[model samples]
Target chain A: MTGSILEIRDLRVAFTGAAKPVRAVDGVDLALVPGEVVALLGESGSGKSVTLRSILRLHPENKTRIEGSIVAAGIDVMALSGAALADFRGKTVSMIFQEPMLALDPVYTLGAQITEAIRKHESGVSADAARKRALGLFERVRIPSPERRLDSYPHELSGGMRQRAMIALALACNPKVLLADEPTTALDATVQVQILLLLRELQRELDLAMIFVTHDIGVGVEVADRIAVMYAGRIVEIGAVRDVIRAPRHPYTIGLLSTRAQGGRLSGKRLPTITGSPPDLASLPPGCAFAPRCSSATSACLEAAPAAVELGHGHAVRCIHTAAVA
Target chain B: MIFYASKRILFTLPIMLGVTIVCFALVHLAPGDPLVSVLPPDASQVIKEQMMALYGFDRPYHEQFLRWLWRALQGDIGTSIRTGRPVSTEISKAVGNTLMLAALATAIGFLLGTLFGFVAGYFRDTWVDKAASALSVFGVSVPHYWLGMVLVIIFAATLGWLPPTGAGPGGSEDWKWNWVHVQYLILPAVTMSVIPMGIIARTVRALVAEILSQEFVVGLRAKGLSELGVFGHVVKNAAPTALAVMGIQLGYLLGGSILIETVFAWPGTGLLLNDAIFQRDLPLLQGTILVLAMFFVVLNLVVDVMQTILDPRIQRA
Candidate 1:
């Protein structure tokens, strides 16, 4: 059996409103092996991003209540407290944000910021050593003139440089797991490819377990070893990347693939269109959240939530009609 | 960068000149002559005419302005009619007193305010923030003169802990090292500093809170930084704005000292200007106004330069 580097089981997060809680991430389960890349693909409201934030306990205090078991590198993250949790966060896992522009403080130079990240995780290290590590990371990420660029503020650098700096900062501590939340969503097309390829190269070189979150399937195709398609707050499908992309079982997954394949032509071909949007958690229907929009949805799908079915090997589909679809 | 500072200072020169011209004309336009203010009401008209001519007040406005400007260029601010001394000497003495008072008060206010602000902002929505916010509102709303009197009533007159009026010990002419004089300064400076302190605390609280919420802060936390690490960067980054706010407050403190100085008999520039106004000593009034305007302009220029240096984004712009 292969050992998994990170495991999140039955994670549920919600915000308390006037009375009941608004479910953000409900019953999410995932596992990542070392040097593996998993793509969590979802639209804006699908709770994919929330799951990533939950792992780090980074939600606003008092606004979110998280209940789950997240074991990262043999440590139970949900049970860690204070300095221990901080220690775990810096050395065990690092995260990169979507907006590279806002991911760095405006006042500090890029070198100072990255060096700060290093010093936070490793104590008693001199500034010279930390800066040396920072320069190395910068070069690894392909930043030009690492020494000269270190003194430049985030505003002074271009978008690509800022993203690379952010990557350098994230990689400073050599975290075991790297969580990237739509990392390249904010960059231009050319810069996006550069950042994505750099992340892939770095992960391969460092043997890092990475969970890449994005709504765009195109991004998932480039670097994802496995893909988990989320709908509303549930994972509708999880399987090997090639399997899911080649022969998607869940109707929602099929709908997504077909619609995106339509390629901006409204009249050229009869393009597939999925009807309706994701359900509102506060007033959700009793059955599958995707039933309202699924073309092949049945009365059973509308009456009761479907259980996960193992199609073959590691592929799983949360729909009763998976066998028929296959 | 040097060009920016010089450009800002050059822009301020015209504003200072405008202030001088308007104030010089307005003082001249006021009812009654300076001679009437200095001499007995029943003095002979011939004597009054002679006094006005001697002072160049009898000349046309433009000619008088040119002569005053020329003398001012040579640092001859003229003599004060009331004190029978050079206006420059009177102003320098008063400026020294006022600057000492304002500087002490501002230093205390800024230090305490920034400390309180960082705490409140760090523990936002908690009891600390609530208490600090309340103090800020009170500081901003309460008049400085009223606060000064209340302080005097409590710490000086009623308690007899310190003197209600007068400045530092060993006379205003020289510096002294006395603990009592320093202690006596507490009430006046504290009273004068209330509003500025409040303003700084509020500004720092807001700036710290904003910085604390930025994406880089989240990144810092994710990098395993303790709360202290996150807060340290937040404060360092936010300090430039806090310092800028303090600078503006310093200028306003100078403007605001008029009432506090008069009530407490501190004998600063504000009090000197008040006396000149009552005595209608035109040379003293004009000289004092010019000096205050120039001081404000210079202080603002320093603030601009500090801000530009502290914030790279501003310098780049």
Candidate 2:
């Protein structure tokens, strides 16, 4: 914990609405140790993305209020204002957006954009030096013909190439923490594997602490050291990736596992899916957020929300029936 | 690229020729002959026929057109019916005056418009941008003649800073070294610049705003580029479209300066054409219209070439 590059304590974010505020991120506590890869796994609208964006204060102002202590690289996120925040964003932490095509500027060549990144963090860096570093980054990301690719615009390259360039851009500053918001989601299966492998290789090479947000549990299993399962704006389960995948504690986590497990084998028949849609943020069920979807929900589960249960060995679950289920 | 340009020019030539032919026919179609208007009501039949023959007006319309076209191709626009002066010589003097005035006005307009437009785009939602927008609207709305009269009232009539009428009392007589004539030319040029300046500023502002919102600008900002740094790059990248707009605006400015020229009596094409109409000078009037049309076509071609040059994507397209 002391070697943690980022720590979010009781982070809460809510959107302003007419009738009631929609709680996007509710009482989420997480941390990423240096060189550790923590996967924030969940379906859409599960607050995984909101938590990621809140770390960088990337959410549009005036529409949402964030309440939390986000400590990244020894700097308090909530306290850092304007220029300090921007400095922190470009130096201590860099992010790769979901859409690689939209991540890089189309007008400029890849090298120019990457050089700009290098220049942003390091003062008085010469343009020639920045370009050299950018070309080196392109090579590091395994982009073939790096020099030519450097001179090419984003549109000129393929989707996988653009994503690699984006990763190069993110790593150019050599930030301690790298936040990838579903970086491989838009790519094809082959490209996704390539990007994922490239990310793991780069992460190992750089010893970078990564926060990978993804909806695919399989992807999370592939790269994450630990997995945090999110449901209805809260972490329902957190543990080592192997332990979480082998034996899920929370009912929602179990539901996710079953849904994904059913898709493991390729068959002519359609795979079984979760029975119901995720809860709407605006009108979450009272007491337990996932109660309505849990078959094991008891009167007590409906009357009171379960507290975080420390199940030993860094595994925690927010469920009243964990012991009974096990 | 040269082949493409040549093909476009060739395609445009016949259309232009057709327009000129239509214009020539329309002038003759108007009520009352140039002969009747130019000559006295009680002229002798002998003198009337002789004047008609002298001007080649006695020939059939088709024959007269062929002769005029032949002369025009030979660079001889024929003598003015009213002034008995060569059309080319008369128009050339007026053209020199107009060139000085129009060139000055256009330069001032482009500089002011581009500068203000860049500023407005930089401080997008600020009061300065709003003020620039308001000024642009005012420039577009106000008539050139009214603007001219206003300038005359403020600078000429009240302050006695410049003369009220004519390019200068010196006229063509001492245009060679007349500093007073140059001083007198300033107001009319400034008045003529208003519409183009306003239009160019408005267009530049919109273009800059659009370019600023592009992903490239956002990427630049994320790289920790200062506002000025981001702005400079964005403007440079967006220059092709912005310059294209400026070129079209320049063409419009040339076409529109006629009213301003006439009001100030700047001895430009507008004034020469007006004089020809009053004197019923058919040759001078026809030649001036043709020249104006040619100027417009040539200017459009120049802008087209410039647009292709500035952006290679356009050239490829």
- Give the best candidate by DockQ: 1
- B1-317 per-residue lDDT for model 2 (tens digits): 79767776887788677757865786788777778867889999998999889888889999988888888878898888777789998888877777777777877777888777887887788899999988888888999898999999999999999887786776654575467677888899899778778887888888888877665555555545655667667766667776776667666555436678777877788788788878778888888777677777877787777766655445545
**Candidate 2 stretches greater than 4 Å from native:** A12-27, A42-50, A59-64, A79-86, A216-218, A229-236, A250-307, A317-326, B1-132, B161-165, B172-186, B270-290, B297-312
Error of 2 at A54 (Å): 4.0
TM-score computed on alpha carbons, candidate 2:
0.81
User: Over the stretch B138-183, how does candidate 1's per-residue lDDT look in tens digits?
Assistant: 9889988898888888888788988887766654556554775666
In terms of lDDT, the best-performing candidate is: 1
Interface RMSD of each: 1.4, 3.1
**Superposed model 1: Cα runs more than 4 Å off:** A17-20, A261-272, A324-326, B1-4, B29-32, B43-45, B168-175
Give fnat, all candidates.
0.74, 0.32
User: lDDT by residue for model 2 over A1-326, one digit each (tens)?
Assistant: 68789999999999984368899998999988999999999999999989988887766566788997999989998997666766777578888878877766655678988887787678899999999999889999989999999987777789999999999998888889998899999999999999999999999989999999999988999999999999989998999998898888898888888775455484675665677788888877777888888888888888776889998878999999999877
Docking class of 2: acceptable
